[model samples]
Target: MKNLKIALSLLILISVTSCDDFLSEKPDNRTEIDTPAKISELLVQAYPQMSYFDIAETMSDNVFDSGMPETLRKNEQSYNWDIQTETTDIDTQAYYWDACYTAIAHANKALEAIEDLGSPASLNPQKGEALIARAYSHFMLVSLWSKRYNPATAASDLGIPYVTKPETELVTKYKRNTVKEVFDFIEKDIEDGLKIVTNDYKQPKFHFNVSASKAFASRFYLIKGDWDRVLELTSDLGSKPVGKLRDFASYDLLSAVDQRLAYASSDAETNLLIVSANSIVSRSYYSNRFYLSGARYPDIFGTATSLFNKPWLYNFYSSNSSITVFLPKFYEYFKYSNVTAGIGDPYVAEVLLSNDEFFLNRIEAHVMKGNIATANDELEYFLSTRTVGYVPTDKLTEAKVVAKYPVIADEYTPFYTMTPVQTSYVKAIAETRRRDFIHEGMRWFDVKRFNIVVNHETTNKPVNTLVKDDNRRAIQIPLHASNTGVELNPR
Candidate 1:
């Protein structure tokens, strides 16, 4: 591992790397990352520590003016579809941008260390994890900071810098890659990682385990309109997805706090990958000026909104003033720096990938592939667990799903074409996803992919509508990154 030592020596010579301090002066200076064990330890930081829930959720159609007096700059900016100015806050868009790159820096460092260790077969797991981690961070970055992937114009759309190599210089100038280039880079990393990725981590749920990696692949292909690949990636989850899906029914048996704690627990088979993120999103659920309001709560989770006409198993809670409403999904844990002073950070255990979401992705793939009956059957079984008082004898047919989600012309106009029936099924799946991941920020991806319109209203202000193909759909690149020569999105 002489090469590794030399690399470490060079790292020591450098100060903080990147304009945003994405890399430290010496990441592993305390101990050499010469061994596979050390590389694995380093991989723990490969996932973004900051949560994008607040930024994304506020921008989606799921929220409205709660009439709450509390306000966070990030929340207000996101709700109004404006560029965020809160660059240093834990839950702001800029913080998440830097956090994603920071995660990528760690992955690149581990990959470099692994290469220096001779790229032995013994370190395949670490190599696989590092590659997938790098891909995931870049994928998130491009998905947020760039326009939605449109094959016809991806070559021209500005993407976030896809950093793959460890930084050795104090300050590295980076240029934004094209959307097509970023997607190409991400796809290459994912395919390579999948070949050798394993589920052998001490805590598989915290790392890019086999299932989580496959879930990510399915998500990527689904967005790219590669229906066949999406199905191939999620095939193992089965058509029924009986035990692999979330047990929402059982969550009702637990206390509210317990449900929040168990939502991201490794014990839950549905949770494929979870990470502790520096976030105040849980607190924001009930405190933000704009959030899921009591008036709009029924529009999403009410019994009439369900296909089976049953109440959702999701538990809802109200703020002290009953203005804001939220699901018991996020659990915040305080990490005390000084126990006596009660000063520290708020962390939320976030489920980045899950069997439930993967299963929905598979169903969408089926719908896109013209397997209407199969998609209907799978969607039926998948929703059963989440629907209260679900009757086993009741069958969900394609006709019924289509009838429920009628094709409103131009409601969803993605790059790929969809038949009327396919459009209905896709709409059904998107709605399910919207309900399933209410406060998790997953809806924002669907909003972009489907070109869904979001009408956000505030007290005494005219309705702010994010219409289809709006330029604001793509969040602007962080001002600091733009100042450093990275391209900002067109307003």
Candidate 2:
């Protein structure tokens, strides 16, 4: 509650026109943030309204949007794998370009204000927060609008400009940094920012408090293939004593408010960082359009085709009779008065980082480092929590894992053929990440990192296929971003 107190007050600081170029306008004079407290007020405004789920989740294979309405053009275009599915509304934009830069602008504003305060230790917290915020915003923008971070080609590949200062003009323009430069800038900010960010906040989950900051570090290190740093940074799991999965069987899904608990902001056990999300995150309308594909559809109910045809449903779920539906990893009941009566909620809060992701991060790091037994232990612990009565027998022998999940061998390409032990652990990490982060945009991140091939031929419409390294993976920069000489990502 205290987090929102300052956050909500300064949320009105977002005064830029959506249609205009990012950072094209200046903030109003009365709203100038001048002090450390005022910087916190403005820094909290650094989070974007919409997440990657609002835009690029369609590019991943987790969705089945055949059920979506024809009127939702952005969703439709993205579903069909259009490289340039541009939306006219900045508020509802698919790529979230304006929203990201607006948050960056806020972070820059906070950093600029702090610079004039005699470089005091009292402002370090705000300074640290602004640095991470700025780094995070640029990271998201670069990941979305530029090529995937291929180290060899990164110096040549285009990346989003890392904006550090507040904009002052109506037509300010910038150039794209190379992917390697973007990575350098983000790493520098995070490495320094984490050192300054202390565990001192009323609402730890809402702000990037110690736990969330470490989790962010883990993600950054994992992306960089620096596993040692990832483990070291996350050794202290901030507030949670144990990273346990939420037992859905104990939940009262029948109640709308109770059902929402899975993603509620106050839930500290599962989530490391909780932030306000786009209204589209709701289960209402386009939310549940998640197409449970033939390759990976856990049919808890007697629904569609699945590799686990027999009693696999009951094996995972302790009780599915009460709740006949299981699709999105996080969901709630919706009330559509004029449309189909019962739907899903459109107001679920977004989870930025979570314990489950860390668990997987550990598993991957350990496996890659040849700590096979430890990696298997991490996988077993995660499974025992997620599935009912899941017991590890014989340290999850690779042969046994392949026997149960042969599809994993193919889904995890190139190195999917790793010796049974390592391959099994990698597949386990991949599957858990997918299942845990359904509808949360993490799958898209995985898709980019893994270079997973995504084909959109599920619907009756024309089929669209994108193999690894396809240009579609790099979402197009908004035409307006090119305004005033800023270069557009090549289409």
Candidate 3:
């Protein structure tokens, strides 16, 4: 159901001691240790932690768009503004951090209770599941709230606390571990969990499974730019037949509710990790905006008239007036309901890492190693698959891309084409990545990684905004962590 509220309630019940008072205080019936069933129930509490996924996705996109008013959303789009110094107070970052830790605590409690079950031979599959789940929750926490791992800086950089126990001990003071240590702990846990959890459990339709762990590994390797490991993990995924990519061009925007909903509900072949739609908005955000006539373009979803109005059908005067109409970005992803619903679950698409991305990575590696022809071939492969119209050659030298997208080149000065082979390769890979994962929370990270200059209208003027070295890169660590002696990342 991807129901986040249920997830939150269950988490609080299992991990927090304050709620223990609500339990019946019959002295004779009270037990010092948790029963197996009780522990299993606690493990179930981890479900709501997926809410962090929705929060991360929305905040990453909505907070960065210029179309939304600052007053209406209030620094939601702006990152690391001086006025909001206490990073912990930021809703998006705070919510994600809290949700992840809560889930981790529940997993820890489950594992501790399993050990207390005594005989190792009697251990249940649920115990291993809990271990893997805890490790994954922690992995996401570090990636989202902290800086990218650098061995040199990791010892000084604060990572989330590695709470392996329920912390029932009174006066238990927690401390943050180094980023490197945290990742090391996570990797070890995953390895240990893999040993215990066999591929025998009936696959839960909307929960984490063994394959999901592999998917996570693939993503982790990709983030670290470990091309060989990325290839290995993704190849493992390709061996298992799962899902397929949906052709975006085939969807009809103006259809009946049931028809539209059916199309929306259909999962894209490549959808890897998603939170459940039922856990977030009640209906599609775009659909609601369109129906209410509250849509705007290049901002939130645009106005309904701007969306459906046909300029060719109108008179010359009316057509001239309609030229100013702008299409909304929201409609690009959310035109259907099914797609919205499948937000939280670990989907197959994420596991099937793109062949295009793989070649791009290979090309980049070659360029770095000074293998010119190999790099050029990889670059051509990527660009050829990107569009149906154009086919690039191995010998295609870098030239100004002014012929295509002439308006952008004309409007913007010094708009150079792919001048260097390395530049061409980077651009080709980045563009493919963007098109492949539109709402998957990869764009802003890409913007930062490539150090791309963001040229867009701030207040309807062509303003060139450089996001490089921006304070917005590191999200504010949660206040709860800070209060508990966990150090915050530098703002």
Estimate every model's Cα lDDT from 0 to 1. Answer: 0.85, 0.62, 0.44
lDDT winner between 1 and 2, please give it: 1
Those runs of model 1 whose alpha carbons end farther than 4 Å from true positions after fitting are 1-22, 26-32
Q: Give the root-mean-square deviation of each candidate in angstroms.
A: 8.3, 7.4, 10.4
| lDDT for each residue of candidate 2 in 348-401, tens digit (9 for 90 to 100) | 357777777876787788887788767766666565555433444424555555
Task: Give a tens-digit lDDT track for model 3, residues 61-140.
Answer: 32233232223231323322222333432234555566666677667766766787772644556676677778777777
lDDT for model 1: 0.85
What is the Cα-based lDDT of residue 457 in candidate 2?
Answer: 65
Q: Which one is best on TM-score? A: 1
> Candidate 2's C-alpha lDDT?
0.62
TM-score list, all predictions = 0.94, 0.81, 0.61
Q: What root-mean-square deviation over C-alphas does model 2 reach?
A: 7.4
List, residue by residue over 1-491, the lDDT tens digit for candidate 1. 00000010011111112222335555334345677777887888898989998888889989988887778877899999999987877888889998898899889988988999899999999899999999999999888888899999999988889898887776678998899999999999999999999999778998999999999999999999999999899988889877878887787787667778788889999999998888777787556888888777888888888889878888776645567777777777776667677677778889999999999999999999999989989999888888888898778987788888999988998999999999999998999999889888899999998898889998989999999989999999888888888877888
Candidate closest to the true structure, highest lDDT: 1
